[model samples]
Target: MEIIQIVGLGLLTTVLVLIIKEQKPMFAFLLTAFTGITIFLFLIGKISSVIQVLEDLALKANINMIFLKTILKIIGIAYIAEFGAQIVRDAGQESIASKIELSGKILIMVMAIPIVSVIIETVVKLLPA
Candidate 1:
C-alpha cells in the first residue's frame, strides 16, 4: 500500500515534471528535489524502527556499542551520500555526484579502521606465535 502510494506519487511527479520542464526547468528541478526529499522523509519512521531492532539485537548479543554505533554511522553516511549524489545528478552535475560518492567511500573506510584493526589483532592473537 505504501509502495503503491509512492509509485503513484512518482508517476504524478514524472508527468508534471515533463509538462513543466519545457517552460520552467528550475521549477521542475525543484519539484523533483522536493519529491525525493518527501519520499526520504516518509521512510524515516521505518528506518528508526529498524535501527531500534538492530540496537536490541546488538544488546542481546553483547556486541560492542561503539562498533554498532560506528557501523550505523557508516550506513548513514552511505545513504546520505547516495541521496545527495542522486539529487546532484538530477541537477545534471555528474562530476559532483561522483565526488560525493567518493567522499562517502573514504569516510566509510576511515570509520571502519578501528573495527578492522580489532579483528586483525584478534586473528593474530589466535595464531601460533
Candidate 2:
C-alpha cells in the first residue's frame, strides 16, 4: 500500500543516513536533502489536487478568486523556501539557510502587498462618505 511505500522510503533514508553519518558526513547531508525532496515530490500531486478542491470551494462560496490564488501562491512559496532552507541547513550551511529564509519572508511580503491593497480598497469603498 501507499503507507508501506512511504514508510519504506523513510526507513531506508534513516538507515542510510545513519550508515553514512560516521563516514562521509557530507553524503549524509546530501542523503537528507534528497530524502526531503523525494518526499515533497510525492506529496506535490496531492497538494495540487487539494488546491483544486479549495479553489472550487472558494468559487462556490463566492470568495474572490484573486485572493484565493494569492494565498495559494504564498503557501507554495513558503513551502519551497522552507524546504530549500532546511536542505541548506542539512548541508551544514546555516548562514545560507537563514539568508534563504529571510529572502522568502521578503518575497512573501512582496507577493502579499497587492492583496493587502485590494482589501484596503474594498474596505474604503464600503465606507464611502
Candidate 3:
C-alpha cells in the first residue's frame, strides 16, 4: 500500500482509539498497540532496503562488518526502547517509561564497549618504539 493509505489508516485508528477508550479502556490500549506494531511490520521492508544500500556503501569503503552490525544493533535497541516507552507513557506510566529509556541507553553503551576496546587496542599497537 502507498504511504498515503497508511497515513489514512493511522488517522482512522486514532479516531477509533478515542471512541473506544471511554467504553473499554483495555480494548482501546490493545487496539493502539496492535496498530503500532502492524504499521511497524508494514514499514520493515522499506527499512530493510535502506539498510541494504548502507551495507553496500560500507563494504565499498572497507568498513568492518562487526562494527557495522554492532551499530545496527544499537539503533534497533534505541528504536524498540523508544517505542515501548511511548506506549507506556500513553498508558499513564511516565516514570516507568523513563526507566525503560534509561535501561535502553545502558544496554546500548554495553554493546558499544567492544568496538571502543578494539579501537583502543589498535591505537596502542600503532605506537612506534
Q: Would you give me the overall lDDT of model 1?
A: 0.98
Number of the top lDDT candidate: 1
lDDT over C-alpha atoms for residue 78 of model 1: 100
Ten-residue region with minimum lDDT total, candidate 1: 1-10
Clashing pairs in 3: none
Task: Write model 3 residue lDDT over 101-126, tens digit each, in one string.
Answer: 99999999999999999999999899
What is the clash count of model 2? 0
Top-down lDDT ranking: 1, 3, 2
Specify the poorest-scoring 10-residue window by lDDT in model 2: 1-10
Clashes found in each candidate (C-alpha, N, C closer than 3 A): 0, 0, 0
Off by over 4 Å in 2: 1-8
Give stretches of model 3 more than 4 Å off: 120-129
* TM-score to true structure, per model: 0.98, 0.87, 0.87
> What do the candidate models score in CA lDDT, each in turn?
0.98, 0.90, 0.92
RMSD per prediction, one decimal?
0.6, 2.0, 2.1
